[model samples]
Target: MSTLQVRVARKVSEADGISSFELVAADGAQLPAFEAGAHIDVHLRDGLLRQYSLCNPPQERHRYLIAVLRDPSSRGGSTAMHDEIEAGHLITISAPKNHFPLEPAARSLLFAGGIGVTPILAMAEALAGAGADFEMHYSARTPERAAFLQRIAAAPYAACVHVHYDSGDAAQKLDCAAVLGAPRADTHIYVCGPGGYIDHVLGAAKALGWPAAQVHREYFSAAPVDEAGDTAFDVKLASSGQVFTIPPGRTVVEVLAEHGIDIPVSCEQGVCGTCLTRVTGGVPDHRDVYLTDEERAANDQFTPCCSRSKSAVLSLDL
Candidate 1:
């Protein structure tokens, strides 16, 4: 959990297969600060870490922008950034982390699909540089894959950007019930894509009543797993009471890193609560979109790299 070499300043091609890059700070220095729904964890070659978001405009300190989407069914970090990343090289990332932030509502509604428009295009440029009040809606599967759509159609809050498609025409695609049916006690929606477009925009913003803390999301992965209903549990480990054995297809962070216990994961697909931990006893099985549902009915905490255990013995706090 250290990294930060950076330097890849600008790669561009933001569309069909996505791309974008930008980085910076290899020697120019000034980086370590970020906000609008952050994320950074590149670190590729072999270990393949991957978590990309942070699409420029958290008051841009020199660079950072991300994007990527080449995943033609990728299991190898978007095919190693579309075949060995290039522009200026460097790489090794991790530093800007945010389990999809940008809270404090009273106006906001982003939602993005396809490349999940990288952190809702940095929360619509930090809610249009803090003048607050937002809109976005994006969706894509046409409009040439929509990654940034002409820089969100020339941004300066480009009239709160809208764009939907899937080849467009059904009253301009994306409806989620005419933009999230009707929940607005002062807005707040967020969402990021893929798992069926964050389950149809949080199930139409929870069938249009919205609140569950105003509906936020991020999940660029994790929701497929079902190794025939995985079970095998047992963890323990309250700082060295070490038990282990988590094997119905391994996880509990790979059985606590096979005993030596690593525990520094980053988006091992539980959507970056970065291996959350701190459970006190069993009942976890919450497959993570990073908690909530009253933090999974207050089970204390879970997500040992993709959560498990409904009580064959969990107990972590290690």
Candidate 2:
């Protein structure tokens, strides 16, 4: 992965307490190339690494734009990104990665919940450029807390976009069925949101007989960390030729980083899929909500954070 030392060049706060940060390379170098629906891992002052989607269009050459919602209960990633990071300060970040890529389809339906709009905004712009049939369903707690509501409302397909405010009225709560009804064979439903929101949309779509392949989702919250409540396991790094024992209370990510193995990681909770590594051996318990059954069956990749090995010793590609 390419590591870039980025300098915060500008900062702005929009409605709904969302803070947008514009970052440029510290040395005034051109930023790494990235596509829509891509995200980068940011290393914060507190040693916490977090992932933020690149919302700005690729046409913006001078800087990369990222929006952060100050999660009050956060472990300080967003809080620090919003409060401490300022213009001229340098920060380390991983190159942009895209696991939630937009697939080719005749038409598309995009769903964004709260801060989840970051990636979907870029997707909408790309769809517009391609002249594809697409609509965006943006839902939030209230109109006041919705970030970029105005900007999104002014997009090319703004008339097709649907905004739902949970506190407004029952009808305002996102009607997944109405928006997703009778999906065309080539229609792809893309969703990114809080765990509950993603689950609701996916579940409802599945119940409506939409094929699993037609639905794509990105999760903002990590899955349950305590798989089986408590179990210690062993992890073997193939390249390093070393073994590490994960204690019951600690996770694979904590142990690996502690050993200075330097596997790229963000959202240490395991939902972001940032610490994903190829599995050389061992059946992963597959606790994460990110991977599909087919992906878990392949056993080629596993997130080191919440997922553990069913076998006594797990071997990793990394």
Candidate 3:
């Protein structure tokens, strides 16, 4: 885990209920270099660790740019990033990390839903630089709500970029089949958006017989956490040989942290893999979106935040 440091955040632009924040280390240290489609966990003033994608080109190493939409039902992160963070105010953040990487492919298709455009915007910049054949599909509720419209409009494949507005009868729903139809040999598809959008695109791609390797996705929503019950269970920490009872209403992470154990965590909702720990013995109710079937089958990794133990006694590598 990278150390979180206070960085000065500068307001760059604002429009359509979204704001762009530029963060640079207060001491003038060079910010960690990151690829397009990479993101960092920003610790807001309200103590929310929210992930924001890097929208600026990597060549601009002076600072990292993040565009955040003030979600109406935000759990606190986006609203904080957009409304509370101001220019020159210091904010804590993690170094950039990328799970939504641009894989090697002859061509690629990028789809963005509303605020999900952050990461895909970076990918577009990277693809444009590499002279790779690509297209961008941006779907927003309306043109006014769309951020980075000017930049994406001027892209080399600008003509290929589709904008769908859901204002009225002309609502542009993402044509998953049509988008998938554009797949060429050795072509890759990247999708990011709300949970429904991601699920729709992924399901449509699979239904089209696209190989799993050819489809990539990133989730922005976190799974809802459940309360613990009165029935407590024992969790043996393999590293410390200590045991703690996980109260029915508490999560594995909560109990471990209470016992002075810190398993790296970013999004406590299980969307991020930062809180993942090895499960030495237990039937884990894997609720995280980060792991694949193979990883879960190995029973070696578990997200203590959202995942629960089916076994009466669970052992963790910690």
Candidate 4:
């Protein structure tokens, strides 16, 4: 994939444990244009790559703004960004890619949890700019932990945005059922955040008879999988007709690389969909949050970084 060298123009502490970075073209030229709900893959030291959503308005081409929350359980990306990277530092990042895109709707409803507000914030900017009808609900653990409170308050569409806190009074809390109400064909819902929070919002919509097509979501991290029942499986490469056994605890990507086969991968958690490969035959266990239920049911493709096989022998179009 092509990449752009950018300079960290500035970095500011947005909240208690969150920091926002403004990246400009290294040569002071215009950067590529991006849309709301898009993210860039930041290439870090030691081959660590992390995807962060663009929070700034999409119309701006001068810089890309991304926020990172210092995750205590980070696999290295968030910790390095918080500790090693500094202002004016040069870095390489991929162009913006949007797997979670905004669709045309009569009325839009957006729910953001913690740092998940990154993409939802951008969507708000776009929706407000277009003069579209929309409502945004932001949830955080506390007032001190919420990022971009001032920015959102200062926005022209501030009246449409609502803030909720876990520590706040129950009367001010979010009532998902009341907000979601009866599903309308012309209304769409978008959610991004922690797995449990996403589940709550989606579950409310589901119970309200919302069509799956009207609801969209993006997961920052997948829920932990129980691998105790995982068993060994075999995979065959289409090009070489080579068959290899994948042990219970080992991943397909790791085993294949040992034999000189390499597949581009990022967010080995299976959230990025970078190592998604075509499956010629056999069923996959489907251990990823990237694909929708319909896509998983098709069984035509699978993410090798974390997903495993269900059949005894699987075939990959490598």
Positional deviation of residue 52's Cα in model 4 after best superposition, in angstroms: 0.2
lDDT of 1 by residue, 266-294 (tens): 66877778778888877888887778778
Indicate the residue-level lDDT of 251 in model 1: 83
Best by TM-score: 4
Order the candidates by TM-score, highest first.
Answer: 4, 3, 2, 1
Model 4 residue 60 distance off true place after TM-score fit, in angstroms: 0.5
How high is the lDDT of residue 22 in model 1? 91
Q: Give model 2's clash tally.
A: 0
Q: Which is better, 3 or 4, measured by TM-score?
A: 4
- Per-residue CA lDDT of model 4 for 6-94, tens digit only, reads 99999999999999999999999999999999999999999999999999999999999999999999999999999999998999999
Q: What TM-score would every model get versus the actual structure?
A: 0.35, 0.89, 0.90, 0.98
Worst 10 residues of 1 by lDDT: 266-275
lDDT of 2 by residue, 96-194 (tens): 889889999999999999899899988888888788999999999988888877777776678868889999888888889988997579899999978
User: Which residue pairs clash in candidate 4?
Assistant: none
TM-score of model 4 (CA atoms): 0.98
